[model samples]
Target chain A: MRAVDTGGYLKGRIRREDIISAAAVVYGEVGYHGASLREIAKRVGMSHAGLLYYFPTKEALLAAVLERRDAEDAEREQLDSPPGLEVLRHYLALASHNVRHPGIVDLYARLAAEAVAPDHPAHEYFKRHYDEARVGVRDSFRVLAESGELRAGVDPEQATITFIALMDGLQVQWLTTPDAVDLVGSLRFYLQALLTVPL
Target chain B: MRAVDTGGYLKGRIRREDIISAAAVVYGEVGYHGASLREIAKRVGMSHAGLLYYFPTKEALLAAVLERRDAEDAEREQLDSPPGLEVLRHYLALASHNVRHPGIVDLYARLAAEAVAPDHPAHEYFKRHYDEARVGVRDSFRVLAESGELRAGVDPEQATITFIALMDGLQVQWLTTPDAVDLVGSLRFYLQALLTVPL
Candidate 1:
């Protein structure tokens, strides 16, 4: 039941989490417009109304799906973060993990892209995510900067935004064309550049 | 009839291009799946099937839309890109331009996101885009390195991907929330840090 299962154990739980996971996969494979509630119900071996019984509306279902994805990301955020060079190494690991099962990253970013629509149900979720994430990143960045791990004068908030942008952008290229994405290597180099400064 | 012209002018000229522009707007405003060919055609004072006559299908239409946006980008590419701070400055200008028409940025990125599906019509376009873009960036970095404007030990290809990735990442934020994007200012800061050691 741990959402943080390492080898991708999110596939086989019978709880609401299972349904949410199935929803993410189905929704990701097809887009929000193309994804059908009935299809998602079918994949989970339930009737359409039955699935609706639990989640209520298509909007609620999509919200739950995004919430689950965010939960997974949030869980990863709690892992013991490495320090100094290890932080860069951890980023490389993160890149490799994302490349291997790209659907996760795709789903996250696709939601963000679609969130721009005025009526997108995920709008509030994305806005909150960005706001809260900016705060958290600023805090962590301050820690790293104070420890001399980060280059001087790097605005934590701006750096956070830029970092998120890089992750989303790189995933766009990688998922669309893996060959163009060096995954771990390109990020490793960038991180090296970022961390390099007069020590 | 430029695809991204946000200012008012020539609204009724060149019916075909106007239709594409409408589709671009709809796609950007409501996202790909949320947009309707009917809405686009309506904006252009045409019927749905009538609009299809010019572009054939929505997929082809989306491709053309992306192509038109890239045309502007290609124009920017034609400029003699100066190295060091100049490259960053021009890059910021590109960001400012995209910010003016966030919808164009949205439309371009949505196509890239959808291209991950094996059957997406835009698959080849996104793939070719990344490949050629990577090569183009590498060549540019090579020029900078040769002219003694690049830091020693910087890999042009890695730098290329990183720059492109950062552009994409920052672009998402910029498009979603333009006020938050300090394109030129922050980019200048990053480049100043990055270009510390020249050639």
Candidate 2:
């Protein structure tokens, strides 16, 4: 009996992970508001009921998709520790990488805008995301400042806000006119201005 | 006969303008996709057919809404001449102004994101908007640079991209957590860093 229970739990966990991967693809292609559970299930070769058994609702699947993207990004960048200016550089590289993944960028752009509504399903998720992201960037700046890597009179908190804002703002432009906007060059220039030593 | 023709033309123009105003409000509230022509007509106390006579389609109404917004913003700021640092200051003030008008901001946020898709109705509008905005900002920076107002080695085009990006990015954060993010203060800080003399 104990062996059977363990096997069942493991199978369910694996199934849930697979469903999340498939859902991410769907969400990226059609956006959160435009995507349907039925389509996501079809992509995974599972019935709608099977998908529900794992996610219960579209919002639940969206949360999982967001978490998976974050995790993958962190792993890809090896962002385990505060890498100071290197993290900013990584962000620029990520922006370039994002150009190749239109669906994912669309997913984020659409959801971020939609999540602005107070009663949106992902509102809390986005609120926490910005708060935590701000703090992380702030701490990175503080590290750079403590080491005298940042320019004189630079405020870590303010730099963090500006850095994050520029990143988010550039994505919209890049999505619209990919060739016109040089996302990495713009960010690199800003960082050079902010840093004591040119990145 | 000429007098009557002139009077009828004036009345038609007035009615068209009235419908555009009502449409802006509706689009701002429910966004482009969520809003309906019937709702906009109801808001203006006009028949649906009458509203259709002016707009022809929802896409046409959306185009007018976007144009009206740009016209109003331009008129409000008097952004006709290159004001250099004053442009940055104006942006900060605009951010504050945007807070009071969440509906208009929401309209912009939603439409801008939706317009990322190739076939979206406002796609061309957004593309032209970013291009024109970047050029205008770049020209302003060039003027400031020539006058030795900008910091040494500051690239006018790069600054243009960063400035615009930060403004757009801050809007997303501000819309979600209005109290937490100081949109104007953040822009002011970035501008101070970019300028040779404090504003």
Candidate 3:
């Protein structure tokens, strides 16, 4: 009986993963607001009911997609224990990577803007996202300050906020005019201005 | 006969302005893709054909709405020929004012993100917007630099890009968490860092 239950749970997890991958593709192609669960299920060769069994609702599916993206990003960056300056460098590398994946970038840009509405399905997710992101980056800056590598008179907390703001802002501009805006270059410039030691 | 023709043109302009105002409200409530010309006309107590007579297509109406917004912003700020650092200061004030008008802010955020697509109706508008904005702001920075007010080694062009990026980025954050994100304060911090003299 125990073995049978374990097999069933494993099968369910695999199915869920497949659904998320398909949803990501659909969401990336069109935006969250533009996509429908039916299209995602069709892409995965499942019925809408089958997809609903896994995600319950469109919002649930969206939340799952966002969570998966975050997990993949963290894993890809090996973000476990990078040093203070390394974290910022990782972001630059990520920006370069983002340029190669316009679909994901568009998905993110669209959803982030849509999620600004107070009643949007992803509203709380984005609010918490910015808050958590700011805290994490701030801690990284604090580490640099403690090690005496940060520039003089620069407040770590303020720098963190400005850094994140600049990154988010640049992403929007780059999305619109990929040829005109240099995402990684602009970021590197700002970092050089902020840090005492070169990145 | 010429005076009558001039009066007719004035009347047509007033009707067009009314339609644009109605479209702005509707677009602000829903988004661009979600809004319809019929609905906008309904709001203004006109038939769909009447609105179309003035603006031709939904895209034309959207363009007019955006143009009206830019005009209002310029007029409100008295943005004709402000001095170097004063432009940045004006942005701070604008951010503060933006808090009071969430509808317009959301409209801009949503449309800006959506317009990132090359085929989007407002694509060209946003592209030209960034180009013009950068030149205008860069000129202001140059004026400051010529007077020895800019910080050493700060490039006017780069500062212009970063400044616009920061403002755009802070707007997204502010729209999501108005109480948490200090839009004006963040801009002030960045400006202080860029200028040789304290703001």
Candidate 4:
């Protein structure tokens, strides 16, 4: 999904992003325990050994996939302190991306849970990501409060982390109970309320 | 850790509760794929088939274990209407419990993730659980708003779902980054802010 950043990297037939994308699919379809390198290689149209030429190992490949998704949030942080409501707008956009990305969020959430084990490939990835996400959202909300746009005493940092939790958590429900509720719409409604509170 | 209210559950050496506790430890130690009936049976001092006497199947046994944790939650809910700062207090208490009951949460999370496949055993269990959790939280928040305890325009229902999401989403974070931050504290601080209005 990335542009030709490198000068036609090895003819671009086997792109780095392509490998990461395929890895994400396998990670989502199968639990990390159940995911097999052979299956991911097959889906990517590479010999099992050939795929290793690109990823080196399944753990490395898994790490790369996780990093690629993490960059999406990092990009949001670069958008120059948009208004608090605007930040919420972007948050909604990212949530939609999760809905469309098909397995990225699920894989992210699932792997995140596993990262608790000290030996997980994702342990460090989650450690730094959580801090950044928590602080970044908090700062964004704080800017809103300073501008006299917040609902007052909103605890931007706290709200920010909690907001992340809500988003992540609802996505879980959506995965398990697609027929039982509309997760996106529900989240959107909540976001709107939090964004605009009447005294 | 319960006293049977004047006359506890048999006041015996080992009983149903002890069996359930042992099952949880085995389940957590090995996971669903790695854990075995023989292991749990041995931990509880019983034959595999004899263990089946109390629980006819492995699945039934697991469900009972999970239900036992949820039962504790229900008992706590009965003790509090959870007004004022207790909103966050309850949230943190719940998170603490989730941490202590890793096996139950881990199993629930795993099954919830797998339930996306449509044929998982915990499919119906999770589907109903999410439905109830979402609707129940929403209704409770609605009551909060109606009673003028909450600021206007905060749709309690949506916020309720949001609260549930926060729990689910952060549990993943807490599992992954247990040492880096206080997950429950962060959420409570946010909820406390959500409740109070600005000067």
Query: For model 4, how does the per-residue alpha-carbon lDDT over B20-84 read when each residue is reduced to its tens digit?
Result: 88888887788865778788889988888877767766666676676676667857754144443
Residues B54-160, model 2: lDDT tens digits? 88878778877888888788778755566587776676777778878877777788678878887887888899889878877887789889999999999998898
Interface RMSD of each: 1.9, 0.9, 1.1, 2.4
How far does residue A159 in candidate 3 sit from its true spot (Å)?
Answer: 1.6
TM-scores of the models, in the order given:
0.79, 0.91, 0.90, 0.76
Error of 3 at B72 (Å): 1.3
Error of 2 at B164 (Å): 0.9
List clashing residue pairs in candidate 3.
Answer: none
TM-score of 4: 0.76
Winner of 2 and 3 under DockQ: 2
Residue A29 CA error for candidate 3 (Å)? Answer: 5.0
| Residues A20-71 of candidate 2: C-alpha lDDT, one tens digit per residue | 9888777766677688999989988899998888888787788678877877
Q: Write the per-residue lDDT of candidate 3 for residues A65-94, one digit (tens) a residue.
A: 887887787678755455598888877877
RMSD of each: 7.3, 2.6, 2.6, 6.4
Give the fraction of reference interface contacts each candidate recovers: 0.57, 0.86, 0.66, 0.75
lDDT of 4: 0.66
Q: For candidate 2, what is the total of clashing residue pairs? A: 0
Ten contiguous residues minimizing lDDT sum, candidate 3 chain A: A74-83
For residues B1-199, what per-residue lDDT tens digits would candidate 1 score against the true structure?
5655733334434667888788877886777777878889899888888887777778877987887777767677442354344554566677667767776777676667767666778788778777767776677677777866776777877888877777776766665566666655555555554565421
DockQ of candidate 1, scored on C-alphas against the true complex (2 decimals): 0.47
* Interface RMSD in angstroms for candidate 4: 2.4
Give the true-structure RMSD of model 1: 7.3
Model 4: lDDT of residue B181: 45
